[model samples]
Target chain A: MARCRALVRPALVEAVGRLHPWTGEMAAYALGWADPAGTPDPTGSEGKGVRQALALLGAEAVGADGAEAVPGAVAVELVHTFSLLHDDIMDADALRRQRPAVWKEYGTGPAVLAGDALLAQAVAVLAEAPGRHTGAAVRRLCGTLNDLVSGQAEDLRFEDRPWHGPGAVSPDQYRSMAEHKTGALLGCALALGAVLGGAPDRTVTALDRAGRHLGLAFQAVDDVLGIWGDPAVTGKPVHADLRRGKKTYPVLVALAGGGEVAHELVTLLSSGRPVDGEAAELVAALVEEAGGRAATRDEARRHLDAARRVLRETPLEPTAARRLDALFAHLLDRTW
Target chain B: MARCRALVRPALVEAVGRLHPWTGEMAAYALGWADPAGTPDPTGSEGKGVRQALALLGAEAVGADGAEAVPGAVAVELVHTFSLLHDDIMDADALRRQRPAVWKEYGTGPAVLAGDALLAQAVAVLAEAPGRHTGAAVRRLCGTLNDLVSGQAEDLRFEDRPWHGPGAVSPDQYRSMAEHKTGALLGCALALGAVLGGAPDRTVTALDRAGRHLGLAFQAVDDVLGIWGDPAVTGKPVHADLRRGKKTYPVLVALAGGGEVAHELVTLLSSGRPVDGEAAELVAALVEEAGGRAATRDEARRHLDAARRVLRETPLEPTAARRLDALFAHLLDRTW
Candidate 1:
């Protein structure tokens, strides 16, 4: 993973730097490196760059050197950035990573354009990448975007529904939604890596399956943290998800328990106010008592285990697979 | 012109119909045939469908039958529809063609998704079209999208910049912006038509040149009517351009003219009220007194004449060329 980062980082830096001045500025802000007006400032708001790392590691898992996969990694990163820009607007999120989200800083109109520029430029970049794999990769990326929108539509619809009440969600439905929402792109990233590495179909499928589970586990952990993690560590207040009545895995599980504590939690979510100190603790206690905390942790473990099983089935070198396993564990365990 | 409409209308209808059910619903609203919720209702708010007609006519002018050019026309119309959807959002318009705009009816997020679906589906439709020229046409359409976005960005920037104020806009800047905002896609419509018609390069160039000039003329005439046309005829209150503080050709000419009326007109524009009735009439009178209206009319005529010359130069069947020429005149002379 470290080796892949060394190779991928330079290309990303150069590609991002050499963009047309205006586009470069936009991309810089997208990457959490610049202010809205293109000033040079990094406020420690950049993501952990997990997606890029996954792209590189996936390539290595298929026996490709990181040098051959940097462009693909950059392409995936740009697409991810584009999604964040639009998602912020759609969700009406004021902050991302620790700074003003794109729409908040630039207004909805410019943010939309900036996101579009990234999307268009991502396609162009993929077209210019040195591989016949480019065509298939581009198509896959487009499909991922469609899935992203589909997932978002469903997510938004839930906000207006009574789905946040007790007994409202199921494991199957949660998994299905999360797979399309987050896992689809992660699968594409691995598939692209395999394609660039010249891996066979079976090898690609194995890597993709591994990525799907990893992404599921990653999302579950994030959702858990979003509701119960400490404010300082998560960089968002505790019970933030409850405030939005987000139907994350833990909330869904608690709702499915159908008990007095579950009823209280549902009421709290519907209250439409910020969940504070004692209330936050009570909500967390209710979530645990409803078996949600344990269930969410268990579900995360199941996905991670499934990913590891697929990793064993792939054609990756032992060292590469080991590094990937370590990366997946860190991803599942990380704070913030 | 009737023959052109006969060829293009059905094609546009079928093509738009192929948009995802939701997107098609939005298209119906854009065309003024349906409400935002996908309900069918009789309405007259549709665009004139000028771009679609031009594509089919341009194809026929170069010897192709309408049947052979349906896909080309459909592709251009989809691009145009997608642009309108996004433009309405960017312009923050409440009504389009007389009906509620897409964003106003569907919300910004859904409207954006609908626009994106149309664009993605447009690519798919173009790709699946049965023709040797399909790939090239689709690529050109993508380029046209890039141009549209660039033009939109400039337009947004223009709103806040004093240099883009009345009298500050040059003819060259006007043409350049219009070429991107309107002319490029219109030219592509003709170019695609020529491709489908199997026309030679000279014929294609002629059609493209003519389309470009016609687009400019249409926009200039639109600017004139924006401030001075009858509200009943235009379907919008008079002096909409002034209220929006748009730097249209007439306003620029009047602003450049050194006189009291020009100064008064500039003040009226900068005031940014919804000027109408008597105040609007007074502003229209001042616009004419400053020679703004005549100057704009002359400029529009120059573009119309240039379009006529392009038609004369093209090696079209005389009947077809005459038909297209008449269509151009009718469009330019339109009062509504």
Candidate 2:
């Protein structure tokens, strides 16, 4: 993985730099390469680069040179970056990766431009990519982007109309949001890999399904951690979702019966009252009692298992498939 | 123009439909095809579709079948629509073409999606267009889109900082913005015409230069109208630019004098106070006194002259060239 990252860095940098030369500096900040002012600086922040990695991983999964997927990888990363920019603004997030979010650091206009730049670059990269499936690649990238935005629209609506309300959000609705918001892109990541590898339709479908399941499970686990996990590990305050009045999977399951505690929690959240330490502790206690925590874990496990099944069904080589299997296991057991 | 509009309607419907099958109904609302809820009703909405008309007109300018430019026309119109979506959001505009803006009706999330969908379709149209300059066309379109966005960024930034404020924007700066925001796409319209006409580089350059001038003039005229034009005709209140605190060409030119009225207008706009009735009249008076109104008109006229010169230089056939000249004359001379 380290070698792969190293190999793709120059290509990624070159492609992004050339395509978005004007906003490349701002984009560099997004990719953790520079500061907000478009100046050169060391210690640029970086992500786990999971999407890019997945692109290459997907390529390898179907017996292609991982390097060949570099453009596709970059395209996926740009899409993800654009979403993070808008998402930060929509959520009014102050921090990202222990630093001020894009909107916080540079204000809304630049933040929005930064996202637009990334989106445009993503298309440019796909358009100029050196490979077969040029038309298909662009179309797929666009279709995935369209779905991601649609998912965001649904998510925004869900914010004002929480599924759980005084109760909890259903697993189904949560899954639906996760699929649209997160899973669609992940599925695209896998599909791009298959497309690059010149894999058959059946194989692409299997990989895409695997990605979808994995994405849902990943989101479900994130919801669990958002409410009950340690802040230090998750980089967020404990019961943050609850405090923010979010209807995550665990909370929904816990409030399915709409018990007294659930009702109290809902009232506290809806009233916009301060979520103090005592309230946080009580919410945690209620979550535990409502079986929300256990239910989330169980659902996450089921999806992960389902993802692995799809992975096994795909026509991946033994070595590549083994690596992916290990990767999934690590992700499934992620504490953060 | 009426015939062009009619021919383009089905294509617009079909293009947007393919671009967003499910959400296409919502897109129709954006294009003035349907009401906010997808109800079938055309209440004298849908702009003159000036870009599409220009595209078809340009096709005729080069003696190509007007219908041949439908996809190209649609492509430009899509870009135009995307700009409207983003601009409405940025400006917090509540209405468009006498109806609720997409962002106002559907909210920011869907507004953003609608823009994305349009951009994607624009590229798709170019990709599928069976033209010799398809590759160059796509690149030019992308380049034009980038320029517009960067220009918009500059425009947004100049909000708090006037043309001659802390981040004082110069005429050169304004020119760059105008070139991108309006000129580049207009250039694309003419370039698409030449591509269809199989015109030489010299002819293309003349058309492109003419377009650039036309765009700059149009923007300048727009700025002039924003402050001093009749409200009923422009569909904007008197001194709309002054009230909104926009650093338009005239405003910028006047600010260069460092006059008290310019200072006062800047202060009033930045204070977030409403500007209407007496305040609006006062701003209009101040702008005229500062010579902004006259300077803007003079600048616009200069561009119009330059554009006419280029049109004369171009090797367009007599009849087609005459139509082109008339079309541009009307565009430059329009009151609203």
Candidate 3:
């Protein structure tokens, strides 16, 4: 992951430099080049580097040097930054990566422009990539954007629905939204990496499929961690998703099966009573009692197992395939 | 123009449908397909159709059927809409095309998403175009976006600079900004159209060059109308730009000469006193007396003539060339 991130940083930095000076500074901050006070960070590192690692690993899997996929890595990361900036505004999120959100720090208008600048640069980087399949690559990335829009819209719609009963979001609906929202981007990264690595269409498609499985696994783990993970690891308060009344996977699973604990859980949640930290703990216990925690873990393992199987089945460079398997396992067991 | 707009509308509508329903609805309203209350417009006709016309006309100029450029035309138009939606948010403008601006009507968050939707669709349309030069075409549009970022950045920077001082925006800087802010889109329209229509590289470049000249002329005329054009025709209050302390072309020219009238105008402007309608009118008179109006007109005329000469010199379909000439002349004389 560090090696792949190292490969991505210089290219990412140069692409961001193309922005207007003020926006460049803001983009730098959002990407962790600068702090909230506009002071440049010496480390200049930001983000989980998941997509960048996936892209490089994907290229390596296809028997190409990871460096060959830099354009894809850079493009996807820029797009990722663009989406996060806009999403933070839409979500009214005050903090990102332990600092004020771009919109909160730079004002909404400039944040919007800064996001736009990153998105435009994303297109430029991919479109200008020196490859026979550059056009196809850009189109693939754009199709991911389409899925992103759909997922975000569906997520927003879910917010308006009741947490339980008639208008509740089904487990199927939640999964589909997660696939579109988060899965599509991970798939895009792998697919773009393979294509840029000169893999055949089938290879690219298979990698994309594996990536989507990982994406689902990733989200499922996050859902579990949101309720029960250590705050030191997740960087969020305990039961943060529950406190916000978020319709996460565990909660949905817990509610879908009707029993005494499920009934009590729904009542406590739907009571509209203020939920303090102790109440949140009780809700978590109730969900776990309803088999929510176990079910969510099983779902995550199911996806991770399926993704690992795909990696084994698909034709890939031997060493890279082993590394990818290990990487997927590491991600599944991620403490942070 | 109507024919070109007709060709674009169906495809444009279809492309917008690809977005999430919420964003799609907002985008429809932005493109004049829906009313503010979410009622769909019966006609579905919207926007100035200038970019669409330029694109199709560019194809005709390159000896191809205008239909060949539909993707390019639609792409550029989407980009134009994207820029306007974001610009309204940045400028905090309340009205657009005789209605509440998208940001004003839908709130900035949804507006930003809507704008982002259009831009992503713009890239998708061009990237998916069926042509040998699809990559180049998308690159051109993305490069135009780069120019747009630079232009908007400069425009915002100009706002922060003193009206008259060491950091004052010069006419040259203003022209450069206008070219990036506005001209880049026009050039992209023509270049993409010609490229997709199978024009040679030289022909595409020439058309892009001519389109940029028209862009400069377009901004110069808009600057003129911002101060002196009849508000009844322009749909703005008299001297609206002056009242807002905009450092427009005419004002820059007026102040550059440092004459007595210029002195009075600067004194009036720098007093930090609120400029009501009467004061704005006084400022306008002083600008006119200082030759600002004449100089601006001459600047516009110079660009128009240069564009006309380029059109004449370039190899193009004769009848299409004549029509383009007439179109350019009409634009130069537009009342709004």
> Candidate 1 at A120: error in angstroms?
2.8
State the C-alpha lDDT per candidate.
0.74, 0.75, 0.87
Candidate 1, residues A1-336: lDDT per residue as tens digits? 455656677777776664435556777887977778777676767666777777777778877785566777777787788778877887888998888887787788877777766665665555456765655555556566666666665566556656453435565777777886788777777777777777887887788788789888988888888887888898887788866667788878887778788788878766776666777778778888998888888888999999888988666877778888888888787652
Error of model 1, residue A219, in angstroms: 1.4
lDDT of 2 by residue, A163-232 (tens): 4444335667667878878888888887787777778878877887888888888988998888878888
Model 3 TM-score, 2 decimals: 0.95
**In candidate 3, how many Å is residue B216 off?**
1.7
Candidate 3 falls in which docking quality class?
Answer: medium
DockQ of 2: 0.30
- Go through the candidates in order and give each one's DockQ: 0.29, 0.30, 0.73
lDDT of 1 at A12: 75
Per-residue alpha-carbon lDDT of model 3 for B1-336, expressed as tens digits? 887888888989889888888888888888888886778876544777999999999999999998889999999989898999999998888888778899889888788888888899989988888868787788889889999988888887787787676787888999999999988898889888899888999999999988899999999899889998898888777887887788889999888888788778878988999776788888888899999999988888999898889899999999888988988898888763
Candidates sorted by DockQ, descending order? Answer: 3, 2, 1
What candidate 1 gets wrong by more than 4 Å, as runs, is A1-24, A53-71, A127-134, A164-171, A195-209, A259-264, A267-277, A316-326, B1-28, B31-33, B53-75, B127-135, B163-167, B193-210, B257-279, B311-327
Which pairs of residues collide in candidate 2? Answer: A164-A168, A168-A252
- Give per-model TM-scores: 0.85, 0.84, 0.95
